[model samples]
Target: MKPGFWIAPEGAEEPVNIFPIGEEALDASHKGLTASGALAKLASLDSEALARSCPRAVELLSTIAAAIGAQTAGAPTQLFRLEGLNDLERRLIDDVLGEGEVAGVVALPDGTLAQIQESVLAGIWRVRLEADERHDYVEIGAVPEIVSRAAADLTASDIAIGPVPEGTMNALPVLAEIRERALSWRPGQRSQTINFTLLPMSPADMGFLQQTLGNGPIQLMSRGYGTCRVLATGIRHVWSVQFFNAMDTIILDTLEVGGVPVVALAAAEDFEDSAERLTQIIEAYFT
Candidate 1:
C-alpha cells in the first residue's frame, strides 16, 4: 500500500497551530524489512537513534516523496509538525526548494508553533524564486533590489516644474512671443490664441502660482507645450517682455500685460548649499 498524508485549508475558527505527525502513523509508514521499510524502522527510533541512521533517513525521505506523489496527484503540499528541525535546517530547505510552490512539511519549534503559523499567514516567510539551470530549481530569497530602484527612478522622472514661467509678462506680448516661438519651433503652422488673466500678487497668489506652474494642465494651449497665466507686479510690471529659447518653441505664452515677474529669488539665494540639490532634482526630470 502506498503511504500518504493529509492536508486541510486554514480556517478562521480553527486553532492556529502546527500539528505534528502522530507516533502511530510514523511507525506504520516506516515498519518493513525492505529499503522502503526503513522509514518505519527509523520511526521506531528516538531522535538520537534516527540521527545516527543517515542511510535510514535518506531512504525515509524517498519513501515520503513517493507517498506524497501517490497521494496528492502532484499538487503542492506542506507538512506541518511542532517539533522537528532547527532554524538552519529550515533555511536550507527554503534555499533548496524548487519554484512553483512545492509542498513540504514544517516542524515548528516546540512552544512557538501557533505563533509561527500566524506569522506565516501574515506573509513573514514569503520568499522569491530565481532561475537556476544546474538543478532545474529556483533559489528562494528576498525581493530583488532592481524592482525598488526602478520604482524610485520612475517617480523621480515624473516630477516637473511648470506650465508657468519664472517671470511675468503682459497678456498680449507674452501670447505673441509664445506664438512666434511656436511658429519658429514648428514652421508653417498658424498660431492659436490663448486666454490670459492678471491677478494681484500675494502669498496666496504665490502659492496658487506655484501649484499651477508646478503641476497643472496646460497641454491644451499648444501641442508640445503647456500654457499658464503669469502675475506681474511691482515696478517691472510696465515693460514689454519676450521669452528666449533654442528651438523657438513657445514654452511660455502670455502677453506682457500689467504686471511684473515677481522676483523673489529668496528661495534660490543659498547658491552654494542648494545648487547641487536643485541640479539633481532638475536632472532627474530631464534625464
Candidate 2:
C-alpha cells in the first residue's frame, strides 16, 4: 500500500483513519494552493470558515487584513509580504485585486496578492508600481550619415547609430553630415525609406548616441553594436555606398541599392587617419 493510503480491517481498528493529514501535512497541501486560482477560491470564503479550514490560508487572509488596517491608519502598503510568489500569481492579484477601487487587497513586491479586510468590505484600490517606472531613463541619438544613407538605400527600417556619449559635440557632426546627404539626395528619391548605423569610435560617442536616441527601441546587434530604422516621414536624400571591409559588408549591402558613393578607409593606427578616411568616403558619396 502507498504510505498515505491504508485499508481498514473488519472492526479491528477505528476504521483506520488513512492519511490523517496533520497541521504539517495541511501546511504542505496549502503550498499548492498558494497559486492565484487556489488563492482566489480561498478569498471567496468568509473569515471564520477560512481560518477554521486552512490555517495557512488564514495566515494569508490575516496578512491582508492587517495591511488594510495599517493603510487605514495612513501607513504605506507593505510590498514585502509576498516574497515567494510566482509571476503569474502576482499578475493575477494585480489584475483582480488591484482593479477598480479595492483597498482591502494589496500586491507585494514579488507579485502576490494579500487581502487586508478586518471586516469584509469592497471598493478598494491596490497600489501597483509600474514596470517601466522602476528603471532610469537613458536617451539615444540619431544614426551616423554613412549608416543612415546606407540604410535608406536598402529600404531597411532597422539600423544602428553609435556609441556617442552624453554632453559631447560628436553627434552634431554625424547628424549634420546625414542632413547634408539628405539635402543632396535626388528629388526623385526624396520620399525614400532610410535606416541608420552608428559606429561609436569612442565611449563618449556611445553615451552621446544614448542621450540622443532617448528610450527608443534601438536593436542591439551585439555588444557595442546597434541598429535603428527610419520612418517614411518625408525623406530628403537617397543614395547608396559600399565598404571594402568584409566587416562592413552589411552596411554596404544596406546602402548599395541607390547610386551612392563607395567610401574606402586606409588602414592606419591614428584615429585622425581613420576619421579622415571616413570623411573622404562621405565626400565621395556626395560629390
Candidate 3:
C-alpha cells in the first residue's frame, strides 16, 4: 500500500488509529474443514436440519438471484437478515461466498460492535452485529449504511472557533467555506465532496485547517493499491480523507463534506454483477 497523508499521521512517526483487515482475516479458515467439505456436509444434511439450514441459505441465495435477475433492480437499498442460523452455518455461507477486498470491525458509540465485510461479489457486504442474538445481514450498495449512519452529526451550534496561532491567515477562508457547506447539507441529498487539494495552500494553511476542524470519533481505513484513511473531523459533515501509496507516502489529500468518498463507494454495477456471481456459486455447490 502507498503511504501518504491518508495512511499515517502527518509529521508523526506512528499511525493514529487505523484498523486495516490484515491478510490473516482475509484468508479463509479451513480449521477443520475446507469450503468444499462444508458444502458436502451441507448437501448430506437430513431433511429436518436441511429445512433449517437450506431455507436460510436459499433465502440469501434468492436475494442474490433476484439482485442479478433485475427483480430488485429498482428496489431501495436492501438488508436481509439470516435468522435462526448458527455460527457454523453462517461460516459455511461465508466460505461459499469467499472474502472480498475489505472488511472492518467498528465499535459504535452505543456500544454495538458491528463487523462489515465485502463479499467476493463486490458491492455485496456481509454485516454482522454482536449482540445477545447475532444479527447477520447481506447488504448491496456503495458502502454499508452503518458507516454513514455512525458518522458524527454536526450542526451550526456545534461549530466553535478557538484561538489560532500567529500568521495563520489563509485557514479562515477555507474553514468558513467548509463550515457553510457542511451546515447546509441535508440527509439523503447527493454527496457534495469539496476537494481542498486543488487549492494551493502552505503547510501552515493545512495545519490550521486540521486544527480548526478538530477531530471526530470515527476512524476508518480501506485498502486497494495502498491504503486510504477516512477520518471524521469533529465538525459535522466534514471528513479528512487521504490516500497513500504502497511506500506509505501520501498520494492524494482532500477533505470530503459528505457521507463518504467515491473511492470507498462501490459502483452500482458491482451489485448488479454480484447477483449473477452468487448464482454461479450456489450452482457449484448443488452440482
Per-residue C-alpha lDDT of model 1 across residues 1-287, encoded as one tens digit per residue: 11001112236332111233332322232122322232233335453433333333333333333332232211222232212444433332222111111111222123211100001111111222223112111111111122112212222212122454444433234434433443243212332333222322333333333332222110000011222222211111121122214553333333332212211111122222222332332233212
The Cα local distance difference test for each model comes to: 0.24, 0.29, 0.62
Instruction: Report the lDDT of model 2 for residue 4.
Output: 9
Q: Residue 239's C-alpha lDDT in candidate 1?
A: 16
User: Can you write out model 3's per-residue Cα lDDT over 1-287, one digit (the tens) per residue?
Assistant: 32222333558565544333343432332133333554556566553554455666656666666764453423455677767777756665666565565665555666666767776666777787766344778776677778766674434225566777676656777778787878787656666665655666666666667667766655555665567767777777777887777886677778877766666666767666777766775665533
lDDT for model 3: 0.62
Backbone clash count for every predicted candidate, in the order shown: 26, 46, 18
Ranking by TM-score: 3, 2, 1
TM-score each candidate: 0.16, 0.19, 0.73
Top TM-score model: 3
Error of 1 at 157 (Å): 48
Clash count, predicted structure 3 = 18
RMSD of each: 29.4, 29.5, 5.4
* lDDT at residue 18 of model 2 (Cα atoms): 14
Residues 233-285, model 2: lDDT tens digits: 11223322212133322342122122222121111222233234323322332
Off by over 4 Å in 2: 1-50, 72-76, 80-213, 216-287
